[model samples]
Target: MELIEVADAVQLGVERMGVGPPVLLIGGLGMPSQIWELSGLTAALVDAGFSVIAYNTRGVAPSTATEPPYSVDKLASDAEHLLEACGITEALVVGYSLGCYTAQCLVRRRPDMVTGAVFLAGLQPSPIGALVGQMELDLIGRLGEIPAQVRVFEQLMTTLSPAMLQDPETVSIWRQLLADGDSLWSDRKGLHGQLAASFEWIMNEEPHPEHLAQISAPVLVLAFEHDVFFPPRTSRETAQQIPNSQFKQIDGAAHGGLFSNETNVVETIAQFCADQRHRLDGGGSRYASP
Candidate 1:
């Protein structure tokens, strides 16, 4: 992992691994690059010929957090700036949860910046989704750092499928990961800011269904079959709103199941990235045009 200073004036703790096509992995709330490292997705993608760029988002220091008045658009700008800093002209962006929000912002704000994008477990703006966001914000605000970390650990525990949890080995690894404590979360203020920023994005910054037409890149929206955080119905419907976007719901995955059910998630994305690379190299677009 290296700390790279981008044009935004913030130095992010970034991990650029392997040697092939660049794939930017944008993690969400309660997730940093370390969690990806633990999930083995990085190595999996690496072996599949992707040079993964995994980085800790704001608040996860060694990566500095931005000051107040945070918005998902600002975070999106940070991501694009990071790419320029790394000298990567274009890349395939893979985002989960809040990271997906940033990806959307990037594609809409700067279409030429990304070759393709895959959104996993993403939430769309809706009345019900708004209420859920409020509940989550209140819950996060009530907890301090350690408690917040524990809360996240418990939340993630629920993201896995029941059968996965039934396996003793799986439970053991998850339990051990949680037992490490505070390291799982970044600074308290950063954590709170991230939550607030996310809530704002989901509630307001998230475009209307019709607004999705502005995005010009090839898009793939992945929904966990049972992701309560972002329902499959909603994710699929959101995909439909984006002209010519692809939508796939993984059968056995939940909100956090992509990690526990790593095989499919990693494999699916790897194939998409490879195809996109091939299409771009051949001066042809495999994905349908907008």
Candidate 2:
């Protein structure tokens, strides 16, 4: 693991393995890259003859939190800086959840540096509006108390996906992450600033749908059949928006099930990448869109 300083003195820690076409992995919101370590997905990808790079997002473990405010655009810029630091001019970007938003912003801002993208359990921009609507600001106000906040966050994660509650490893990692973020969460000023940035980025900014037509690079939109946060329809809509995109729904999986069910996830991605490579080598597109 190595730390690369990006914009705003955010020290982003990245881990790289294998040697081949670069595949940049971006984690979901509030979770550190270490979750990937526990899932063994990183190792599996590395063993599949592809170079893999996974990094901690800003405010996550091993990555320095930006001062008070940070937007998706800022996070995207941080990714760009991290890629440059790693000497990666172009790569196949893979993002999960909030990281998917960052990926969209990166491709929009710097299309030249992206070869292709894979969005896992991704959502449309308006999804955040639904999330904020469901959230009770009054409850968020009381979240200033660390213990209560931690409990709430734990319950929230469990409610989002019961699999989280059943998986001890996932629960443990989540608790540890919450503990790490305790200070930031307790500081009302900081928490409010971060929430404001998140809300602004999701609601105010145009959805990636507008730029989907502009994305020339092939995209694979992967979703779990039982994702609580993002339904299968979300993935279908995302694929439909992109001119050159395909969608696949993995059965018997929840939001985080892609990690738990690593074999299927890895195999699907490998096949997609292999097909794309073959197409580039004069093989016509053979995979049908979902």
Candidate 3:
């Protein structure tokens, strides 16, 4: 793990493993890069000859949280700065959930810096905004109550695919992590802030679909068949909005399955990246002309 400073002196913690085309992995809200650690997906990507960088988003562990208010645009800008700081001209961006929102904003703001993008279990505007709003309210209600907050979070985490919770190693790691009261309290504040920013972005920010035609990079939308957060239909519609984007829904997986079902997710991403490379080298545009 290396500590790099982003814009405004915010320290971003990143782990760079592997050695090939650069692939940036962004985690979802509340969770840090440790979530990816559990999946073994990073190691798999490294073995497949891709340099992978997984970082804690702002307000997460080892990253400095902004004062009270934060927005997706700010998070996107942080990503851009982090990339520049790392001397990455263009990279394959893979984002899940809230990270997907940040990835979209990054493409919207700086399309030239993105070679390709993969959104897994991404939330779209409209109904997703409603769901996020409810989550925000729930978080706010438990802000002052640490025990209640932890209890609620544990319950919510368990609601994910049983495979995730059933893994003895995974559950043990989670238990040890939760045993740190200071870490839990600090993370709770960050999580609440992230939730607030995400809700605001989903409800008030310009729709991402409007800029789909503007993205010049190849895009892949990956959805799980049983994702409780954002349904596969959302990913399908997102793919339709982006010209020539590929959409795939993996079976027997839930919203967090990208981490739980590591083999399939890694294989799918590897294949997609290979296909995009082939298209780029074949003198054919990967993204259809709008």
Index of the highest-TM-score prediction? 1
- Model 2 residue 169 lDDT score: 86
Give the lowest summed-lDDT range of ten residues in model 2.
281-290
The sequence of per-residue lDDT tens digits that candidate 3 reaches over residues 1-290 is: 67789876688878877666677788887667877777776776777666777898887877887665578888898888887777776777888888988898898888877778888777454464466566555756766433545544553463356576678787666556555634632345566667776787767744466687777788888887766666787668767888757888877776667665533887787777766554333232222111
Model 1 stretches with alpha carbons more than 4 Å out? 7-9, 123-132, 139-157, 165-176, 179-181, 279-290
For 153-236, candidate 1 gives per-residue lDDT tens digits of 666555776666678887777776656545644566666677777878766747566558877678888888767668888778
Model 3: how far is 277 from its true place, Å? 3.8
Q: Which candidate model has the greater lDDT, 1 or 2?
A: 1
Error of 3 at 42 (Å): 1.3
Q: Could you give candidate 2's per-residue lDDT for residues 134-231 as a string of tens digits?
A: 36333455664335564456434632356556778876775665555544322344344345455666666445567778988888888777676567
Give residue 283's error in model 2 in angstroms: 18
Quality of model 2 by C-alpha lDDT: 0.67
TM-score per candidate: 0.85, 0.78, 0.82
Please list the C-alpha lDDT of all candidates, in the order they appear: 0.73, 0.67, 0.71
Question: How many times do residue backbones clash in model 2?
Answer: 0
On lDDT, the leading prediction is: 1
Off by over 4 Å in 3: 123-129, 138-159, 162-189, 278-290
